[model samples]
Target: MRVKMRSKHRKAVKFYSTCFGFREPYKVLIDGTFVHHLITQRLLPADEALRDLLSASRVLGS
Candidate 1:
């Protein structure tokens, strides 16, 4: 699944930058911290992360 980001968030910029294939640099200051945004070729299934978290929670009964 393709996730289109309409607006840039510093948190996301930092996160996405950490991923491989994402090297284009961008910046945002979040909570007084400077965050760098990088280009990324990685496309994650939007629901995959949530699904895993939910499944893990169910398994652990948390």
Candidate 2:
């Protein structure tokens, strides 16, 4: 299940990058709720997690 989800996400990223003009160092909008969840889930230092999830070299947060 996890692998499938990862594959799907990768495909989506590829599609967007190819069809559109999306590039690396993807920009992400972080909200309060997301921050709360991260803290509760012990996933602090959000940048690392987002980078891994997005398969990006870097992550620019807003």
Candidate 3:
């Protein structure tokens, strides 16, 4: 994880995998990739809300 995430953008991607979420124990997932895709597609309203959360926390760019 450290090797792959050496930059800010990459580190931000890692947050999706580590951050709290609605996880399905029965349905396996590939961590960050799945959630990242959904965010890019804007399929979830929480996507923008979450970015705003990060911005407020000064974690990511607005």
Q: TM-score for all predictions?
A: 0.22, 0.74, 0.26
Candidate lDDT values, in order: 0.32, 0.81, 0.45
Highest TM-score scorer: 2
Per-residue accuracy of model 2 over 1-62 as CA lDDT, tens digit each: 27887788888899999999899878778789989988998876889877766777888766
Among all windows of 10 consecutive residues in model 1, the one with the lowest summed lDDT is: 32-41
Residues 1-62 of candidate 1 have per-residue lDDT tens digits of 23333123434545665774444322222331211211132223423333332222222112
**RMSD in Å for model 2:** 2.2
lDDT of 2: 0.81
Worst 10 residues of 2 by lDDT: 1-10
Candidate 3 lDDT over residue span 11-58, tens digit each: 564565469552222122235875786679675764344444233332
Which segments of model 2 are wrong by more than 4 Å? none
After the best TM-score superposition of candidate 1, give how far the Cα of residue 14 lies from its true spot, in angstroms: 1.0
